[model samples]
Target: MKLPLKRLLGIGAIAAIVIVIDQASKFTVRNALAIRETWTPIEALGDYFQIVHWKNTGVAFGLFPGVGWIMPFAGLVFLALIVLFYKPILNGSFSFAIAIGLQLGGAIGNLIDRLNPEIGYVVDFIWIWKYPVFNLADCAVVIGAGILLITLWKSDLAAVKKAQPSESGDAFNKNFNAASAADKTHE
Candidate 1:
């Protein structure tokens, strides 16, 4: 198969996996714990970490609570943008594909929660020391964003390297200038 087609398939697969995992984890959390309920899986880490069934009607990390009504619209816009620019944005890189897939999944996962009539808020369970409760979707988004940044950085570095003249080119230019001067002197 063509590389672009392969990449698209890979991206779709990764996104589907992320969405399934995120949704399944959220479902399990919701069923196992009531809203606001907390469970400490490791007693030794109880002070540092716990699984809490928390709800957020806002963006990631519980920011801007109660503004979730706008999220569905925003998510739709994001999906539209992805559909419009996936080729250029992905740049035919596997890393870029993975990053976009992860982000897409995360966005869709949270959008699903926001759009659900029964549960209009995102279900967050994972919690760390003094940190806001979040879910697998949030983790996927963050990690995907990080990967995207790294991929962009690497691409920029490669471009810069390609733009700069290599040592062999510099040596050839010096030799050509010397030969030209020699011929002019011999004339």
Candidate 2:
């Protein structure tokens, strides 16, 4: 379905905001924090916030290997997804689009740091796990992914519910059976 032009533009604007916020925060952190320095945890709901200086050559929570040679490969994946899913970003619900924006923004932000830095590692300077230190870009990527997963789950559920009754109807059942059989035959 075609999205209203206004909504489309709004989503674009929100995405822009994500990019701005993500980059600006990273820049601020870079300027303010000393590398490898850990600050006292900033308490929130249960001791979840803090600002420090850290870097990761790896992926989510520093899971993968070091910066090594994987940075460009991962960056390519990010770019591909953004390009492949551009339609969803433009046409999906407002929240979903914002989620995409956050994901994209976070990815691009970290990629910038990794690509530009001498060691090519993303600066990651916030920790709550006594965990591998992370930064705003990491937060954006995680939260955005969560949002995407939730939205996809919800959409799937909706589709299932919407399909069930139709599947039971006599005419729909006939058409569905034929379609299913046809699909099987093609496979």
Candidate 3:
């Protein structure tokens, strides 16, 4: 079934915003710094927080490197699954929509980099402590997944509560038991 135009537009807008910001930040970093160059804005926090120009040909946090060619295919499959199973997102609350949008935007942002003939790797700049260098797209994807988990947890709790027998049901059972006892006595 077709989704509501308004809802689709809202989700699309969120995704577009993520893509634009992610791409723009990556572009800025690539132009401003040479590859492997680091820039620390705060002197004291330099060791903890800094931006560096790095490239990852693999998935998040540079995992499974040298498999860049397969990423595009995996991304395409991800997009297809999102489109095919969108009913749950559409029926879910606003948070669910936001989660979906963030995920889509992140996936597309990385896909764009992988598709680029000139730079067939994702640009990552943000650096925090000893963590692997990452980018805004990665952040969005992680945050989106977190939100999705929370929403699913809440929905499960609601379902469980609904499935439990109500107080009225308990009262009815009590009355039926009493009637059955009376009938046995009469018999």
Candidate 4:
């Protein structure tokens, strides 16, 4: 439950960066699409990617629509994950910590977006091949979560292997040594 000062500080800093990037990109998109009025596809991967503008009032992939209550619910889940995983997340491994950082940072980013908007709409502007529009934060969260799950699964497998009774020579060495000592005393 305890987090080292360095980790706590690193988490805070990354979260702040996420917020900044999310808001800045949103503002730019809003100005271009609303205030200044439009951007064409920044580039095209033969219909694979584009930079477009859309507003989403739901979780990733536009899962909900017009459900006003879900934003805060998403935010709560976000907060809970960060708190629950903080310590092991910090101590675990490289990929583990980075994945957690990405998740934590992305969560904070979207949560901030929902806080002030009139209907809790998030500004989403990235366009990917035939997919629902999303923003930087969404990408971070999804990729991070995927990596985190993979790491957890791998570690669980490793622990299981280690706990199995193995054929190694050191297996129960101390126990056998103690038994031999007792036998000598008896003789």
Which candidate tops lDDT? 1
Off by over 4 Å in 1: 89-91, 165-187
What is candidate 1's lDDT per residue for 12-85, written digit by digit as tens? Answer: 88889999999999999999999999999999999999999999988899999988788888888988988887
Candidate with the larger lDDT of 3 and 4: 3
lDDT of 3 by residue, 63-161 (tens): 888877788898889888878766655656788788988988998898888898877899999999999999999999999999988876676555444
The estimated TM-scores of all candidates read: 0.85, 0.72, 0.85, 0.74
Looking at model 1, residue 77 earns an lDDT score of 94
Report residue 183 deviation for candidate 2 (angstroms): 15
**Model 1, clash count?**
0
Between 1 and 3, whose lDDT is larger? 1
Backbone clash pairs for candidate 1 read none
Misplaced by over 4 Å in model 3 are 1-3, 166-187
- The Cα local distance difference test for each model comes to 0.83, 0.67, 0.82, 0.68
**Which tens-of-lDDT digit does each residue in 68-93 have in candidate 2?**
35766776887797667665555666
Candidate number with the higher TM-score (2 or 3): 3
- Model 3 / residue 102 / CA error / Å: 0.2
* Candidate ordering by TM-score (highest first): 1, 3, 4, 2
In model 2, how large is the Cα lDDT of residue 117?
A: 52
